[model samples]
Target: MAGSSHYIMPRAEFDDAPKLLIVISPYYKDIADNLLAGAKAEIEAAGGTHEVIEVPGALEIPTAIGIAERMSNFDGYVALGCVIRGETTHYETVCNDSSRAIQLLGLQGLCIGNGILTVETQKQAEVRADVNDQNKGGGAAAAALHLIALARKWSVARKGVGFTNDILMAGKTDGSSTA
Candidate 1:
């Protein structure tokens, strides 16, 4: 029996379709391909657009996103990768550090969905990445879309006191204007 039931969120509609960047670590190319398929499907279904870039490994995913944030025009980011637990403690370091970095970036007010799978075995990753199964890649893309919607909802171009031309001119002369 499956450990869980299928669950999917309602489809989202957007006024201003988001332009997204998908940063994937092609450490496992096959898994990455599956992930990309799912992510692309979700992005297209939502009427959003995305571009994919690959880094060497999971460790580089966040750094790539950070760089893209400063250098690219994407409204949101989807981080996709898989890190199968290994015999060495390196797995933990990679898992923890990458996840932490992604979270930190999100807290910095970037829209990001982290889809790095830190699993005990390849089988686990396959199950999660399967399009008919967990479909974590699509979920991550959906997550980014939701966050982008929220960001658009609460976006602040500017927030402060306002003044008309007359008020500004009068204030410049008298240094006080109730207008």
Candidate 2:
């Protein structure tokens, strides 16, 4: 049942080419490599350029993206990592906190694709990270590209910051009543 289901991903197109920052936590070197390969392929397929950065662990991925958003000019971000369940509750903490932070950042209007894999074992993570199989990294990139396209589509040019010309012409700039 794993590979039986399919999702209809939105077509990732943009009027202007987008630049994406891929932040990865490479605790598992092989899995990270596969995820990065898939993400790169997807971004390139959509005519977008990307830069990859490595963080220490899954918990750091969101922080890296947040810093990049404030300091750099990337149009979007892709977060990639794998957290396998262990004997202790550290796995739960990492998975929950990392995912929550990513979600909060997304809510703040950042075009972010979350590719972090939380699984019971390394085998499960391998299957999901494999480009030939689930290709979650590619899926995440596509998701980010879609968001960027949407933002571009709905974006409107700002004429000015203050009130409109009509409001100014009315001579009612302040809340005080003339009467």
Instruction: Give the best candidate by TM-score.
Output: 2
lDDT of each: 0.90, 0.91
TM-score of predicted model 1?
0.85
Compose the digit string of candidate 1's lDDT tens values, residues 1-179. Answer: 65767667786679878999999998998899888888999999999999999999999999999999999899999999999988899999999999999999999999998889899999999988988888999999999998998888766543333755665666376666565
1-179 per-residue lDDT for model 2 (tens digits): 74587766766886678999999999999999999999999999999999999999999999999999999999999999999999999999999999999999999999999999999999999999999988989988999999898777666444455677665557777755545
Estimate the TM-score of every prediction: 0.85, 0.86
Flag clash pairs in model 1: none
TM-score of 2: 0.86
Candidate 1: worst-modelled 10 consecutive residues by lDDT? 156-165
Q: Quick one: best lDDT, which candidate?
A: 2
Tell me the RMSD of model 2 versus the true structure: 5.4
